[model samples]
Target: MTNPCDCDIRLIRIDEVIEITGLSRAAVYRMIQKGEFPRQVRLSVRSSAWVLQEVREWAFSRVSPTGLVD
Candidate 1:
């Protein structure tokens, strides 16, 4: 058993990821290939999704203390 409040795990598809990160489809895959981004979870043979929290964290990590990209 797991506690719902213990984790707010969510799965988001590529389109949502693009919208959240403001990156193109190719850019997302490219970053994943280069190990610069979080990899997607294999939901099935033909479907995949990323952890929403992980993606959000990745976006947040890109910001500098000056509140801008450095």
Candidate 2:
């Protein structure tokens, strides 16, 4: 069984998110702008990344048996 704690839970870079979600950078940003996706946290003057837990939870919501998106 997959350990819940072992689920990706690190702030991931845009490229890594793209790799995981198979979405273009533009698309991801667009989703963020629309408040339809998890937003990234600023890590530096220009670097930013999203919480792996939040992203995984979001994805989980979409595929979960329940209709809830939380």
Candidate 3:
């Protein structure tokens, strides 16, 4: 049997987020400041991360449907 703990969600770091969203450091921080992005959960005083699924959803929400471009 597999350990139940193995199902725990993984936390992604800022660098991974940047890679996933293809945004610069400044741009991501700007979105967060504007309340347009998912907030990061603090792991420690020196560390923070975002839920992988939440980030993915945020990105997906910004996608334009085909033929809907202005």
Q: Each model's TM-score, in the order given?
A: 0.91, 0.72, 0.79
lDDT of each: 0.97, 0.84, 0.87
- Of 1 and 3, the candidate ranking higher by lDDT: 1
Q: Please name the candidate that would achieve the greatest lDDT relative to the true structure.
A: 1
lDDT of 3 by residue, 1-70 (tens): 7758677577899999999999998998899999999889999999999989889988887777763423
Clashes of 3: 0
lDDT of 3 at 63: 77
- Which regions of candidate 3 deviate over 4 angstroms? 1-8, 67-70
Separately for all candidates shown, the number of backbone clashes (residues 3 or more apart, or on different chains) is 0, 0, 0
Over the stretch 25-62, how does candidate 2's per-residue lDDT look in tens digits?
99999999999999999999999999987877767767
lDDT of 2 at 30: 100
Number of the top TM-score candidate:
1
